[model samples]
Target: MGQFIQKTSFSEKDFLAFQDKLHQCLEALELVLERPGFGLGEPSIGAELELYLLDGEGRPVLENQAVQDTYDDPTLTLELNRYNLELNFTPLPGTGAPFTALQQQILDNLAGLNQKMDPWQGQVLPIGILPTLQERDFGPQVMTDLPRYRVLAEAVQQRRQSTGIRIEGQDSMNLVHDDVTLEGACTSFQIHYRPRGQDMVNLWNATQLVTPLMVGVSANSPLLLGHRLWHETRVPLFCQSIDGLNSQSEHPVPPPRVSFGQGWLRHSLIELFRETVQLYPPLIPILSDEDPLAVVAQGGVPKLEELRLHDGTIWSWNRPIYDPCNDPHLRIEMRVLPAGPSAADMAANAALFIGLAQGLSEDVEPLLSALPFSYARTNFYRAAQHGMGASIYWPNAHQNSLEERSLAAVLEQLLPVAEKGLIQVGVNKEEAQTWLSLISDRLQSGQTGASWQLQQYNRLVGNGHGNHEACLQLLKAYCHHSNANVPVAQWPDL
Candidate 1:
């Protein structure tokens, strides 16, 4: 979705030509994958942190372009909404103290952004969904003035005709939208891991398996439109916001544009790309001049521009990325985690995810057999809905069956697995411990970003504050603690 296309509307001819190019890109990808040493670089990790910009009163502010102009940082980029900005962090080698390095980069970049926003009386916030967001905040007017975002909104609205969001948790709420701007309300801290080609299948499957645990422990964005929704409201909100098919349509609806996935990757990562091409119609079919097949034959890297643009539209929770820049590589974009609490919490979340995926991949086959793919999918939503309080089905290796377990208890058992996985990936022993210990403390305290927000909001409401005032107070304290870089587990209630 980051790739920019000037045209807002596509003709039938454009769609057909783009489809042909997509197939060509797939052929080129096969050749590239078969080539020795391709995508076999040293493992590394990167991240994109999406944030919300707010005014002094803790309301969403439309000052992203101004901040971008003043900051003059290449890493800072605008998101779907004017109030949102994303920071792209540099990739670091997945060894030694990578998490520590990542933590520092997050802190530094956020500090710079906040400082730049000071002149505008704007503040930067990193949260899954800003609790203070109102229904009026998500209209066509709030979308960023970019061709890519406009075209995307038009495309989604064209397909679905109308967007409806109905989420049920502690409370139930139903809303409608004319465009996809509602998705902009759900910010995330997306982590990227580049693994060796041979390990892609195992690593990808392991990532899917462990996602529920990660989402549960790091759950945030519990409130949306002043309603107490899922622990991670972003999960459901994002999917429903841009869903292409209407329930009233008589045509057979395909899988959602945003989804967990139809099933596991049976053979290789190629399966995922193939599924993307086959299952979803092209949303943005902008053509490129270069012939991918010709580029592969001439021993050159093919950009696969159309394929990448189309892939970006399919918002899989764990998406596969094939980058043709420099040395071509494959990356698993871990999109399940929410954006904030603090930089420390985000780093720990990344460490836990990368470590568990790598560690579980060693014996992923057995684990997958013990816990069916369907179970894994169910567990993901369960965790998102209930956070640490959710009960998920896990593989009981000794019993050779799946059993329902509390998310917190499951996380406790997985800590050692995560640490081992990090060590196996060449991370320093103490570095691994330093980050995983945060997860440990978070579990013990039973206070994730979601729980903390809910607690504070309810506490304020109990003291006779109105819903809006309570949300504002929650955001104030949240920003204060987040800017202080204090972990959510250690945050004090208002």
Candidate 2:
């Protein structure tokens, strides 16, 4: 979804042509994977940080274009909503304190945005979802003025046959809408891990198995549209926004665009690609002119644009990425992390995830094998609802019982595995301690961002403050602590 297209609406002929090119691209990918040393070499780390643009009063600001133009930086770009922006990072090798380096870049970019927003009274906030958001804010008029976004909204709406998108968490958020613009309400800090000389299928499956555990510790979004919902309401909000038909209909129901996955990868990435092509219909079918097979036949890398574009449409929590261009490596995109509380907090979350992935991948038995995929899937949603308070089932190292344990207890045991994993992946012991220790303290303190926000919000509401007014006050306090560069666990309650 990060990529762009020349047009929005597609004709039948255009779709057919695009499908043909997509098949050719898949064939090229297969041929490329067959070569020895394919996607080999050093691992790299990268990320995409999505942000919200807020006004002086802590409300969403629809001035992204002006802010983007004034701050003319290549790393910054527009998101699905006009009030949203994204910051991208150049891939760096997974050695040293890459998380620190990434954090520094984010701070610098954030400072630049702050400076540019000063004149317009627009401020940049790193958050999962703006607390001040209202249903009225999601009208089609507020969407980014991009044809591709419009086409997506129309397509999702068409597939639903005008049925409203509905999600029920702690508070039910239902929308009788005609488009998928509700997705724009969510923001995330997406971390990318490029593995080198490793079995990507196993790494991906392992990541999926542990994603619920990660979400449990990193939950940050506790409020949406003044409603107290899940720790990360973005999960259900995003899934329901683009949801389509079910099996009860005339046609078989394909998985939701935003999904955990159908099942673990059986053969390799090829199975993923084949499933995508067969399940999802093309939305942006603007075909590329380059013949991928011809380029590969001449010992050259071909940009599998069709395959990538299609892959982007499937919003798997953990997605497989194929970079046949400049980087020329295969990477796993961890889409479970949310934005903000602080840069240090975000980096700690990243450290925990990458380290856990690396450490867990080293085990002789895959984590997925030990835990059922359905259990993993269930754990993800449960964690989303209950955050650290949730009791999640894990394959115990000592016993054969299928008993459930608190997320805190699970993290206590898993944190060491992540620390070892980071060290194993060339991260200095000091650097790993610097970041991973924050997560450890958070677990011990029982002060995840979500918990902090919910407690503060409840306190303010109890003090006779209206929901809207209290949210604004909370945002102001959040900004103060976030800019202080302290981990969220250290933040004071209202």
Please report the candidate that would top lDDT against the real structure: 1
Give one digit per residue, the lDDT tens place, for model 1 in 338-436.
999899999999999999999888788877778878789899989999999999999865654568889899889989999999998889999999999
> How many clashes would you count in candidate 2?
0
Once model 2 is optimally superposed onto the true structure by TM-score, how far is the C-alpha of residue 464 displaced, in angstroms?
Answer: 1.2
Can you give the lDDT of residue 406 in candidate 1? Answer: 95
- Local distance difference test values of all predictions, in order: 0.88, 0.82
Q: Give the TM-score of candidate 2.
A: 0.95
Tell how far residue 286 is off in model 1, in angstroms: 0.5
Task: List TM-scores for all candidates, in order.
Answer: 0.97, 0.95
Residue pairs with clashing backbones, model 1: none
Best by TM-score: 1
How high is the lDDT of residue 294 in model 1? 93
Taking all chains together, the TM-score of candidate 1 against the true structure is: 0.97
The count of backbone overlaps in candidate 1 is 0
Across 1-494, the per-residue lDDT of candidate 2 in tens digits comes to 54667587778998899888888988998888888888898877899999998878887888888888988888888888989999997878898889999889888888889887786576798888888888888878788887777777777777764355555665666667655668888899999998766887777777877888889888888888888889988898777777732422333466577787778766687787777888888777877778999999999888988889888777888888888776587788999899997999998898999988888875625455566777877889999988988888887545565668887898888888999988877899999999988998898889888888888889999999998988888888998898777898898887
